[model samples]
Target: MPTTIKEKTVLKFEPVHLSDLTKITDLYFSQTGIEKENTNFEQPKLTEEFGFPIYKLVEGNLIIGYSYFTVNSSEEIVFKAIIKPEYSFGDLESRFINQSKQKYLSKKELDRKGMKNSIMRMVDWLNWSR
Candidate 1:
């Protein structure tokens, strides 16, 4: 395990393109493993691409994780997140989440709700699996 999360690692959040789904699926399966006792998450389907927005969390040139979320009546509900095993430390997760929140809060289209009142439901999938 890393002794400490990389200091001020510049994280970039980018939308996942159709071409990226294969990589996402591969990583998800690798991280979740194939044990029968492990929680089984539905494999992402291409037909359901329009259902939610997925963002890949990047540090420099490497893609460390990905998150998919949908907005409900009261809050932004994060359906799932898959982070690489090596970069799954709490500090990195916290930083990524905070940045994601800020990105959503700053969206001009969501101004009607007022950023302060916007709610975000975070799911720590890595720990939740254990």
Candidate 2:
């Protein structure tokens, strides 16, 4: 289990599995209005190439959002929180920043005075599981 946001949501950060391709594609298409060719067929390959981890944000039994990251040296994280259009962006950004700060602290503690690459490597290993 990865870190949770707001003590109510459970964050599952892992590689994209065969079982979740459909749901991931559906959520992406629903949110972005752009359907990829062979979403179910090509997504796995794309995910592998890009080193992306599918993060499912769940509250209780309901999934609230999805976030993904590209595991680069900088660990660039691209996230999209699925919510109603009426949701407040300000509050959402603040919460996201806070959660990210917590993750940063945890990483800092694990690095043991190493450089950022070590931390990035740790994140990559955590995502890739190898």
Candidate 3:
């Protein structure tokens, strides 16, 4: 029998397990949409050894979402986050990110190299209108 989490509960962050990759990928595609036929959705290499720490959001035993982030100095740079649509609610993403920041701050060292890159370096990718 398949178990589902239909009610909102206290959520916690846990390391993204190998078995959770499929669920994460499905959520990503579902939210982002597959606009192109050749859109190659590669699973991230979840590890802090390479500076990216990925976590799965769980309430009880069910995985509801996953976040990928890197800590640069005191800042946590979130590369991607995807939650099951049913669980997506106002402030949920921000709260999850803040929780991730707290967890990573205590568990890993900040990336000094990432800190060296300034916002100006990413000007081309930013929209001034926004």
Best by lDDT: 3
lDDT for model 2, please. 0.43
- The order of the candidates by lDDT, greatest first, is 3, 1, 2
Write the residue-wise lDDT of candidate 3 on 4-123 in tens digits: 879657977888765665565555556666331344653332223122326888878888887765444556554446788888899887777777767766876766456324332322
TM-score of each candidate? 0.47, 0.38, 0.54
How displaced is residue 102 in candidate 3, in Å? 1.4
Error of 3 at 57 (Å): 1.6
Task: Give the residue spans of candidate 2 off by over 4 A.
Answer: 1-18, 36-51, 71-90, 97-130
Please state the error at residue 56 of candidate 2 in Å.
1.7
lDDT of 2 at 119: 35
lDDT values of the candidates? 0.54, 0.43, 0.58
Candidate 1 lands at a TM-score of 0.47
The Cα error of candidate 1 at residue 44, in Å, is 9.0
Instruction: Please provide, for model 1 over 17-99, each residue's C-alpha lDDT reduced to its tens digit, 9 standing for 90 to 100.
Output: 75665566556556666332335664332222222335788778677787654445565444446779777887766666566
- Superposed Cα deviation of residue 32, candidate 3 (Å): 1.0
Using TM-score as the measure, which candidate wins? 3
